[model samples]
Target: MTSGRDRLIEAATRLLTESPDREPSNRELCDAAGVAAPSLYHHFGTKEGLLDAVVDRAFGAYLKRKRGMLRTGDLVADFAAGWDLHIEFGVQNPVLYALMYGTRATSSAARTADDRLRKALHGLRDAGLLRIDVDTAAAMTTAMAVGCVTQLNRERRRADDPFATAMRSTLLETVTGLPASPSEPEFAARALVAHLEATSEGFTAPERALFQQWLRTIADTTRTVQDGQHQ
Candidate 1:
């Protein structure tokens, strides 16, 4: 029971995520969304307008999730929560993350989208919710979290191995400038779950199933790797 505008936005979101390299024709998107071409123009005006709307919708959802999970009263807790959400978003919706933030085609939109995240981090700093300088700490924290998620994605795709534990250890050490410890693993798992629960919208049932399969594969790989290490 989606309206024409809603259907158009949904179609645009999918195209933006799945095919950002080239612009999708209005006709194609309309066909995909089961809407007519005139309805797209009536609602969005033009292709660029449609793209802008798509970016807005995508980043709007992301910001809403981040804001919802704000750990404003404590520095370490806030950092941990933010990092967990970042990793979870990247893992659950790699395509959307890449399209919105990591792709060259959407670099302008990415920067615009990033401003929202930067603002949240800055607010945390203003509230003394973080111990480090706002800009440096935000950059470092985001880089480490995104790197961990990207590495996890690569490992999952290759079915090569699970480096979640090692990545979590490294991230804790690098971002917080803390020594890695045994307790980090439990923290990382908690963070992963938090992120997944927060930002896993726009995912179709099929994509969710694929991700679940990958998770199982990674779990099996982790067990094998841990056993080998012990031996």
Candidate 2:
């Protein structure tokens, strides 16, 4: 058996999700939930209270999935997926996504999502994929994602739209300074790591691992410095 509160939430969810145009009036909500007007007041105190609950229930899953993303070590691929999910969720739940991020005051859930982005950017830095510090990368990534989603939500981008991919690719290229194709230096270094393993390189597995690590540091730094001088 559910209480009046749950019933009201369920009804509101069904109605609002069906259409985020506007909130149902108290009478409509009460009628849909089979409860009295005062029951809503008794349970939620005010219409805002009920709306807050509705927002929480709607966005909870989005937050969870955002926090859990990109477990694979492929930072580039992971961030691309993250961008897709952000745009998709926003496009699907415009009213709620806007309400959550539309405000100057971010909710706790939003902050948590922001933290996850920073952590992922840091992972990119660890992989020698970042051109800037972790903080700058995270800020740039967050800003770009929010801007993309907000604009796409306004434009009502479809699943097949190329705008999301275009914007994501552009932002990543600008921030990371990576070519559209794989970096030649990084490619050569990765091939060397594989060759070392394939030929046994007169070393054990652990020794090969350490050698590859140092090689990556040198190759990444060399690229970074060269890219800087050309700017």
Name the candidate that leads on lDDT.
2
Candidate 1 C-alpha RMSD relative to the actual structure: 8.9
Clashing pairs in 2: none
Off by over 4 Å in 2: 17-21, 25-28, 37-45, 67-70, 133-136, 180-231
Model 2 C-alpha lDDT per residue in residues 119-188, reported as the tens digit of each score: 7788778888888888777777777777777788777776326776677778678767775433445534
Q: Which candidate is the best by TM-score?
A: 2
Compared with the true structure, the alpha-carbon lDDT of candidate 2 equals: 0.69
**Model 1: lDDT of residue 175:** 45
Those runs of model 1 whose alpha carbons end farther than 4 Å from true positions after fitting are 15-23, 70-73, 103-132, 157-176, 180-231
Quote the lDDT for 160 in model 2. Answer: 29
TM-score of each: 0.60, 0.62
Clashing pairs in 1: none
Candidate 1 local accuracy as lDDT? 0.61
Model 1, span 180-223: residue lDDT tens: 44323334443433344455676776775565456445544554
Report model 2's TM-score to 2 decimal places: 0.62
